[model samples]
Target: MGEWRDVFDIKRDSAPVEEIAARIDADSTVKGANLVILIMAIFIASVGLNMNSVAVIIGAMLISPLMGGIVATGYGMATYDMHFIKKSLVKLSFQVVFALLTAAVYFSLTPITTPSPEMLARTAPTAWDVIIALCGGIAGAIGNTRQEKSNVIPGVAIATALMPPLCTAGYGIAAHSFHFFGGALYLFFINCFFITFSSFLIFKILRVPVCGGVSEAHFRYQRWFLIVCGLVVTVPSLYMAYVTANENIRDSQVKSFISQDMDLEASSVVAYELDHGVLIVDVIGAPLDDQEIERLQASLHQYGQLRQTTLKVVQGPASQLNQEQVQEIINARLANELKNDSGKSYKELANQYYGSYKRDAADQNLLRSLNRQAPVLFPAVRQISGGTLSTLNGEEETEGRQWLAYIVVSRQLTADEAGRLQQWIQTQADMPVVVNIQLQDTPSQFYGNGIDWNP
Candidate 1:
């Protein structure tokens, strides 16, 4: 057993191409079995990534049909087997298409548009990935040559992880983002080229004999063909890597600047967005004074990349900061002006005078009453009785009068309709019973302001 293990181990590191070809040819059932496995694996992988299930995704990788395709690709290149090449290409293409369709269908049905961390992680392939593929392919080829293969095949599978790109491609199709397609396809090409080429090198190392009439001329022709293919695949990948690096560099610069210069804690930066020519920094924690703003501007100037800097300072959590607060403040000032000018409450002035109904129900009704105008339509609410009612008796007998706080919610009002509403509400009878006119904003549009409690 010890001698057999030693012999097997030696063969494992030698003559990879012949051994892999022999293995495939020896088992007549391999083609069908592999095809089925590949299909299942791709489908599972697509679903895993779409659902963002890491465990399922790894499982898919473990049993991926990618290795067969890669092996076929190597066989085709090393032995000049066009038939094998065509077969492998067809098999791989079918698997990828199926996987992509499956993933696309899943994503289309699901409601997740923003990419998960795993999805985003696979987008940008790097130079290191090429190195890993080269090494993995070498190990895989060496192991395949042996009678008793080690765990190298599994390691290669996990390392290369070809299913992810195809899965991402499906996500792109579903999300209607071709950028994802571009990135994913690039990754696929990277895997194909490096692994195939590495296998070619291994075959040559193992002294796999070449076809006789596949002459020097044909060989040279094939070499040029491969070189051209390599160039075609590599240029875009390089460009993507550069772009990713630049983005990383920009983020690092921004983070470093914030850490070094700002008086506030770096953790306080709730949302920081860097665009092509501008940096929009939103800090939500405490309100910033003018002096802090000046210092921030000065620090930003040192970076010298940004054409414009929009600094938004809010009090509370960054996520809690209502970006629309500035707009609301403007609207509030406008409401105050319209009310003052019209000699009415804000709601009345907007509804009756201007006929603007763009404001929400709460703002509109309140402004209307302030403008002394009656709303065109009154909203209905639950009637709760609580007040004392006078009973009809010569002795002045008293009974409890039902008291209910009436809630009147108005729809969105435009400026012109708001003015008219204000004016209209002003003409109604002022009864002290229980009438509450509430203007309610749409839930989607309502962003409450964050006030600083620390100060």
Candidate 2:
């Protein structure tokens, strides 16, 4: 019993009250250097979100100064320092506004408008996030009261993650996605509310002494307000967690049913789409007869999780499948695979993910440059759009990737107009590009990807 008490005790090595209070007050004050660090943290976090680089995001968290303010505010509450609490809250609010506006401006001007994995993760925080914030806040508070500082403070900053979500909210503002803004803002609020509340609990446990004094009525009032605020912040996260858990369970069941249970002959599953409890699986090779499809659908009951899920199997030859849809599925699969694999270096992984953004930017630039250059080079050309096409041998992409461009025009071009356009494309690519000229009546849409229609 004595050994257990010795091991479990926290007040044994606590710092002097004055020293601890002074430190918390210092950290809580938002000033010149801290403000600068906060702004820099926001940009770093925003870039990490833009690039989908987790390491960069972690680096940003390391430098973030928001934890100081949060912990200090909690200490203030524990000590009943209303004046200090007011000052800290005011400074913290200013920091948040500065960070959000800076992030919004950066995102608005940047070319990478697409949401990255880091960005998406913040936009849909659940109960798990709340738990993490609480644990992190508790750890941070305990660390701050210690006579010696430890890695726990920095680690807590990363775990609670105050900066990324704010920047994601800024991104939502820049992108005009109210859904993203609201969700991310809610996540930030969860972190802030829980962390501060946890710190208050820890400070009380450690028995942080009151500075001036406290009235009984004010203490009760503050306590009730905190309770109400906690409820308000926590309920939505619980609901989100429930929804997220169901989605994950449904996805797992659908995948299991597709891979293990649904038996098909002379066909392979190509892509899938799950929506509102409906599962749509696209397969290529051999077409299934209606009876076989019905059997597969009926077999969903075998998996308890998928019983409510509606399964529809679409079977057609590779030529009949939607090329754009299949390509998107492939890209998503590959990206997710690489993201979860711990085998790759973070730099290499970053490149792989960042390459997708670069490709999108490149595609848009090409379209703009080509369209602008079109009238001067080939007046007969109305507009140009281009994409990469994988040369397929059967259902497998065998040859390689090639740039496929489409030129939309109302009438046939003169020999000079046609010649210039072809030369420009080859010069730009440094490789032979397959060009497709469309008549006003019949514009070509990646018709049947397996066949090479290059003339």
Candidate 3:
């Protein structure tokens, strides 16, 4: 126990109380050079977040003066120095307001409105953030008390990341997104409160002498007020962290269930929404039957969080098989299964079924036009398939539809020849056409083997 105590002991050195107070007092004042530094830091952070550059953001964090006021407040509160506390709070408020306004103006002027990963990351405060701020605050306070300070203050600033959250909140303000604004502000508040709280604890532990005289009743009231304030900040942060953790778990389970249970070939989850015990999964690929969907829903019971979730499976049009087509596919699959010596794998059978289904579903006139004109224009072409390219949102354009033709060629074709073929196809079909050419050729000095010969 004596050994442990020695290991954990923090011994004060040559740094006098007056010198420490002066330094804290200087840092807490936001004017002249300090105010300029704060504004520049905010601008730099805003730019870094806008450009999604982590290095630039870190640099901004290093130069940020926001931590000074917070530390001063914590130190003052710990020593019961009301004058010091009032001065620190006022300076901190000014810095916060100035930083927010500066960042908001910068974001409003910039054209790039999309949130970067750094920006989005600061929008959500978690339990981990509280822990980080607390630890960082203690480390920072220790560094401040030392006679010879190291680079710990810069490290603490970077770790706490006070600037980015303010910039993110400013972005929200500029974009008029209340959700982003509120969440980011809450994150900043958490960091500020925890850092101050931790600093208070550290100062008290270090047994710093009180600056002014006070009555016993007044001291007790002040202590309770601080405790209540800490609780008020902490309770909501704990709940937010819980919600965030649960959301992450739900997302993981959703992905696992989709990948493992859903047996649709060439399929992908287009979108999903989970709300109030209801999960809506929109999948694009071969549609699942009622029995298969039921099986999937039943299988979800293995994941405790999703056990009570109501599953709503939405089928995309690309794989929405009609009753007759579905029956034909089932019959073909059954026949393939019955003949174990069919010499074709299950994947091959499925591919064949999908090909036939797509061909049948294709526009007859467009398919005929492609089949007739592709060979005429490029005799080296062996197979041709055409389809209209849909937007990412799965919406098909009525006008100016982009028709894509995927052609597999027996021999390599030159860029000019491919271009000519594309123009001829467009002329024959009387539509906007995009030709994707694939070549089956041996490896040569000029070209690689089985190249994607696009023009």
lDDT of 1 by residue, 274-355 (tens): 4445554545555677887777777776764432555444345545545365334335644543432321222332243232
Q: Which pairs of residues collide in candidate 3?
A: none
Global local distance difference test of model 3 = 0.77
For model 2, how does the per-residue alpha-carbon lDDT over 113-138 read when each residue is reduced to its tens digit?
87776787788889999999999999
> In model 1, which regions exceed 4 Å deviation?
1-18, 24-31, 110-114, 265-270, 283-292, 303-455
Global CA lDDT computed for model 2: 0.79
lDDT per residue for candidate 3 within 1-455, as digits (tens), equals: 98988777775352677777778788777888988888889989999999999999999999999999999999888888888889899989888888888888999999998777678788778878889999999899888878898899999999999999998999989999887788888889988998998888877887778977878987899889978987887788788899888877876787678668764676655444555687766566766788978887898878977989988887655546553555454455445433422212333434545654564455456778677767776788777767766445436443345667777788778777777878887775566887777664543334323233463
Better of 1 and 3 by lDDT: 3
Measured against the true structure, the TM-scores of the candidates, in listed sequence, are 0.61, 0.72, 0.69
Residue pairs in steric clash, candidate 2?
none
Q: Could you arrange the candidates by TM-score from highest to lowest?
A: 2, 3, 1
Q: Score each candidate by Cα lDDT.
A: 0.61, 0.79, 0.77
Model 3 error, position 98 (Å): 0.5
